[model samples]
Target: MTAVIEVQNLTKRYKDKHALDNVSLSIEGNAIYGLLGRNGAGKTTLMSILTAQNFESAGTVKVFGEHPYENSHVLSRICFVRESQKYPDDATPRHAFKAASLFFKNWDQEFAEQLINDFQLPMKQTIKKLSRGQLSAVGVIIGLASRAEITFFDEPYLGLDAVARQIFYDRLLDDYAEFPRTIILSSHLIDEVSNLIEHVIVIDNGEILMNEDTDAVRDRAVTVVGDKAKVDAWVADREVLHREALGRVVSVTVLGALSDDERAEVTASGLDLAPVSLQQLIVRLTQKAGAETSSDNQEVR
Candidate 1:
């Protein structure tokens, strides 16, 4: 499949700091992408640049095969749903949807209305008067109902409760199945969005750390459970990402997929392999960022 979004050597500098350092990533069509990173890691910066909402210090970005900045042809095919979306002080959810209906070619008024009812959003209330969760709901509805070919949702569930978040995820998947467009979701709630994402893009300190199919990433690490001594012995000399112990039992997640022989050996040793959690995998990848930087410093010296 052709890439719908292509970013090459994208760099965004803020005075002395580099917000995005030579970042390059391509996202394919009809895939749900999870853009994940710790705070200040440039996930938002990259999204802004891709959507033409922010300028890049140096690099190229192509959305739908055209530059997005000031280019209506490319811009019209995309929707950016931000947590803190700006609205005219007196604008209400009804007004927001009305504007979206005019902008997005594939806008579905019926879908928007359904979302409003499901989210219990007050359409008549001024946007400024709406609570944080309500404000988020407005953005979520616009994003889902717009049916843009490529939609970027930047943490659109900030103040929503667990139930509301679930509703958003379910509705997003339902709508996506019917529409079949590329959806790039930037979220911190990894476990919640894990099942929805087809691919995972991890950023650390303004650079791409890991970009792979979610299933492939899961296979990169295997969690072993058994007696503490047996699990520890199995993990020895392997790159252990996470370790947890419960009484005499221990669970250790180590990098690398085991071969048939290795798997048989592990079971023979009385240790069982468990599925690695997406959250755990991401945590280990991002947490090692500091160690990676430190090693770079040493090499530079």
Candidate 2:
């Protein structure tokens, strides 16, 4: 299948920093992709470039088989919901939805109305007067309702509480199931959206660290928590991602999965086997290249 998005030798630089290095990636269409990274890790820069909201210092970008810049057809097929989406001072959610409907080719008026009611967004209230969560609801509504071929959501649910966040997730998944489109989400809420994302793209310190299936990334590490000595003995020969300790009980996040014999040995040694946290592993991977996980764990190179 043709890639929905492609970046070749991409680099974005500021006066004194490289927000994105020589990154190259291809995104297959019609799948939910998690663009994982911390703030200042180039997630926004990459998205903005893809959506033509920002100019790239160098390299090439193609969306839907063509460069997106100044291309109305490509631009109209993409929707980017930013954390700080701008609006007219006196405009309401109704106005915003109206504008979106005019712009997006596949705008679903009925779907937009359904989302507005589900989110309880005030149609008459000015967007400037809405609460943070309400504002986020407005963005989420447009994102879901627009039904663009390639949608990029850059932390669009900032101030929403757990319940509201779940609503967004559920509605997004439901809509995606019926009408599949490429959805790229950049969020710090890793585990929460883990289940929603089938593909994972990790960026760290201005470079692509990992881009693979979520299941494959999860299989890259395992966490073992138990007696310190046993944990250390088991992990000493493996690369350690992170470690934490509470008195004598130590939890070590190792870089690879245990073999059958290793798992048996862990159980035999009274060491508890546990799932590794994707967040912790990503956090460690994003740290300075040579930096290890602190004194709690030994970094076995």
Best by lDDT: 1
Q: Work out candidate 2's RMSD over C-alphas.
A: 3.4
Task: Evaluate model 1: give its lDDT.
Answer: 0.91
lDDT (0 to 1) per candidate: 0.91, 0.89
Colliding residue pairs in candidate 1: none
Model 1, 1-301: lDDT tens per residue? Answer: 9999899999999999999999999999999999987878899999898888999999899988888999999998999999878999889889999999999999999998899999999878999999999999999999999999999999988789989999999999999898899999998788989999999999989999899999888788888999998888778899987788889999888889899999999999998999778888888877777777899999999
TM values, all candidates? 0.94, 0.93
Report clashes for each candidate as comma-separated counts. 0, 0
